[model samples]
Target: MIKTFKSSLFLCAMSALFLCSACHKEQSPIPEVLGEYLKYHAEKGKTADGYDAYFDLSDGMLAAYSNDTTKAEIKSIINKITGNKNCRNIYSLKEGTVSKLDKSQTELYNYILNPSSYATVAPIEETLKRITSQGTSAFLVTDFEEYSNGVIQQQNYAKAYFVDWLKKGGDITFFITNYLENGKQKHLYFTVFDMGEHSLLKDIENALEGSKSKYTRFNLTANVVDIEYGYSGTKGGCYHDESGEDIVSVTNESGEGDCFTLYKDYHAEYYPFNETWANIVKNAKDLSEEGNTPKFMHLITGPKVNLTSLSGYNVKELDLKVTNIQDDFIRFAGYYEYTKDKTINVDENGKLLDEYNYPNKNNATNMPEIEDMLKYAGCVQDGVATLNVDFDKDFNGTSSKVKPLDLLRVDIVIDECEPKYDLITKLFSWEGNNSLEQAVRNTLQEVNPEGQVIYTFFMRDGGE
Candidate 1:
């Protein structure tokens, strides 16, 4: 998932406001919005054991009116007192600690730290005062974070919907954080903007109404399992075998004898020695002519040891297998042998191995024509490759069906300077301000100035 944070316009406003009122005497504490948010966390009683900070507003204190100097001073004090540790779970709702905000603003604060983030259109102060904005329009802002953990851009898709709701005589603002954090089980934060005038009570009511809007939530748990394989030797044990009656063979106590002799006197069991059993005799001429008897052997009842655990055995030769035949998801579990002697240095001329790669062809014409060229744009399962070049229909219009056989050269615009034979989405992303096709055109001309760009344009066509 992309780990980017697309900032809403509210962030810009907040920055400007902070710079404006960062410094001043008789300053206030953390904004009431954040204060109330901390209070909520405190009330929940789930906050980790640490310093908990809060805030209260002073008279004539304006969140939008603070100077950078005062803000900096306050931040400095917070840094000095809290150091690197979080505020202990103590609610310090003081006016001079941080800027003061209103109850709705507090809700906005909660929304930010909550995964389900969105902005509203009511001044938090007015909301706290139980006032409402009549005949006023409000907007809900939704933002996204990118894969590189950067703010790419703020989206305004919700504005039209928000305006529609407002024009319908909606009297409240609702914000919610319904998504689960993806990593590190960290806290999520959001900032709700008061884009319109309205009463706090009505805002809450509206929020409640909008609570029925499409919402999604998720949580994840991690589980890990491990398995490993190895050899053993039996000491102070003599191999023995029980023979039938009538034959009582005897052997000296010195242990030198044939199998039958030892079986009767010393009760030695006659068993197959090893895998490469050449002869029962230790120094037979034919056995010597062959090779040394295998050292390690296997037996169902005899003393046996895992060869992997034995000394001098190369552990790297071991193999592992994992299979998932019945389950919602496939699983893999295995471990490598950790014997120190198993490590071996390879020559510099050794070739490196890879799991996946496209064929390195000299020219596109010589390459095999992919059944679906779009599917193998960059040779991987990238999404951008599958983008259809034919203009099937206009997307921006009311009609949803694509006109049959309407083929046009589509110049899919994207952020990439070079068109890769990868999946459509991976090859190029239309994440920035320009249209995908436009971006593609600009990038294409830059790369191939002499050749004409071959592609169709994506548009609603207005005919739908």
Candidate 2:
């Protein structure tokens, strides 16, 4: 059976390299980033949840191998230090390659430095060697390592041993799972931390309690964690109060005392562009009114799925809007709105644009496979415009199999240019196989050729 890699859970196994190293000296300074992550987990538990610790030894190794610096000679030194005449076990080399000083060596070195760039069938180190042996750019492939149990233990030891290493500066982030293999579910927990303070942790706790996602449901009890307590076995799922009783049933799921919220707290931190886009829109309106300047408003459009509480439940369509109002910033917001109908002209000889077509997408939804779920509407104006969509009926289904057709469609209208905005719009199509979120990214990239993307995932249901 194929394991469903839920977007919210089950990360592709990345290398165990990011973890701390146990073989380090006690006086060595800990990488501040790892420390912040640990503190966040201990205090907040938001982003730090389920994160296997990693210590980046690549920088040190690279420094040792630098061409100019004679401060350290890594290869020969390490070879003799192991004292094993056999280099095979000490260093994993590429196939058909006996030495690390061959043409593939540079490729392997690049892969080791940036393992995240390549897709490796094995850990970063082993995978890099394999790819390099094929006489190709390691950058040409995907390389990520799924941390193993041994890696996890090494990480723990690094944290324990390298207390000084963490004294350096770094930041922390966390991820929360909608569901794990175990039936454990509760208000989502996450945390962020810095060298000087633990407020990020506190903020994460608060966000968890205040998160709008229904998946953030916690159990109640002393040893048990929940958003609702006291009334689970007695009253209904929600907590209730007695008539002026000195002591009421201790069932208050919203963290009766001292509980923190995850999303509510870190929402701004994660979604920095919320106000940035709003401000841009407001400024554009003011400018337009003052000078009658014709400004272009672009909304990068795409699909949104509301997978909140999908276990034996139903939901409604979740509407989303992506607006780029300012320079180098974009905002993606989820809402409840009527699905808008949009039509675009495709000539009798229509050719797909390369920009809108994201080639590496493994999860692209085919039109035929989702024919019942999606509806193809028109090729109007003598084949000038074609419209098709798949929408969520209520966005209430537990799986994507039962969503409404025409759920989300956005037209990014460029407002101003020496070149006509219409000319730019013609260069791209809102209807494509890419997800709504990706569509937004593509649209924004066109508007600001140099702009960076800032995306946020949200879900809004009016029925609630």
Candidate 3:
């Protein structure tokens, strides 16, 4: 009996040990796939509402430029807008007032053909001011030539109004159509103001397809950077399956809020997080006299990393490790920087527990000396534009290794993203010497000094 009792106790001890081991295994952290995280955050632009149509019946537009092609284009525009059920109102901008005109084709055609039947023309600024006041997406047809007193003042006012509109998330597209007027080249402007959430500009662009018009779309809204993972020739444990497309999950390390587990024995030949410029405006016609197409650089400034849940990190020592440095990484390495010292409290699940003052400035006080460590790589070469992460050397020229189960939280903050000034100048300027055209160009340069953040996404290291 004593032997049997001893044996039973030993068996119970072994059973308890097995159960505890099973529980420990169950509690182990599992990594999350990086591709799944990106797929989850990928969003599409929202569709906008209808549009309002406006036509300028000014004397300059009626008297100076009346030709068969011009009239056909005007008629096509009017007919297209009126035919669409989404077109809400048609207004004739003349006589210093915005008069509501019938949406019928006959009425609009008659008004266009017989300028004498209409009242005297008003300043073009009046029509622009009315569009600004209504705060809706609109389509306007005009000559863009202001022939009135205080042209500078009118241009300034128009610039101020449009700048405010752009600041509040608005976009503009200028369609310049050229026609022959008695052997002299003449131009007419068809402008689209995309205010609020109305995106009728694309529809109008589609309507004018195959027509002889030059397009310059000014999207003043913040540019959303596109993050693509597992780019071409990517390898290692980042992927989840044999297909090599889906990424593995990033798991938190030991329930620590900040520390994470990426993967074991992971070495990427190419950096996984590749960023590309979004919402690039493609001009329809090359207006350069030298036949040189304007090259654009999407300058990304003030990039920093932050915790997904917390406002900032509070750790004393932070290290960045980069291996396999490439030559292209040295070009744009100045843009990446580390965050300054800040106190943050997060829960075990990586949720913010206390309120912290988030840094708002562009200058980072504590920066890592990782010159040529990582860069915003890729540019237009041979008519192809590519942007990605290409890092070839070690951080600070010192070899720092990423151990197994180390998780990194990369938050790419794009403070300012815009094209170089040369592109902006080419897009806004025209062939004629018009003061309003120059003013519009100046306003574009001033307002677009620093582009806004059109997109925001987070990246993590590790996968299950």
What Cα-based lDDT does every candidate model obtain?
Answer: 0.21, 0.22, 0.41
Residue-wise lDDT of candidate 1 within 252-320, one digit each (tens)?
Answer: 122222111111111112211221111222222222343434321111111111222111111112111
Each candidate's clash count: 97, 80, 23
- Supply candidate 1's per-residue lDDT for 301: 17
Q: Return the TM-score for each candidate structure.
A: 0.13, 0.17, 0.52
Residue 208, candidate 2: alpha-carbon lDDT: 44
- Write the residue-wise lDDT of candidate 3 on 1-464 in tens digits: 00000001112212221212322221111122232223222212222467788777766566433766666667767767876877888887676677788747877777776768455554567777776776677888876555455232334446766676555456666676665445645556788888543446667767677665454444433221222333232232122233333222221223232222232112111122221111111111112124533321222111222211111111122222222211111111111111111111223443322221112233322323233434544332322223333333333312232221222222222323333445434444444444444556556556653322222222222211
RMSD of each: 32.0, 27.0, 16.7
Candidate number with the higher lDDT (1 or 2): 2
Comparing candidate 2 with candidate 3, which one achieves the higher lDDT?
Answer: 3
Whole-model lDDT, model 1: 0.21
Which of the predicted structures, 1 or 3, would earn the higher lDDT when compared with the native?
3
- Measured with C-alpha atoms, the lDDT of residue 88 in candidate 2 is 22
lDDT of 2 at 113: 46
Per-residue lDDT of 92 in model 3: 79
What value does the lDDT take at residue 67 in candidate 2? 28
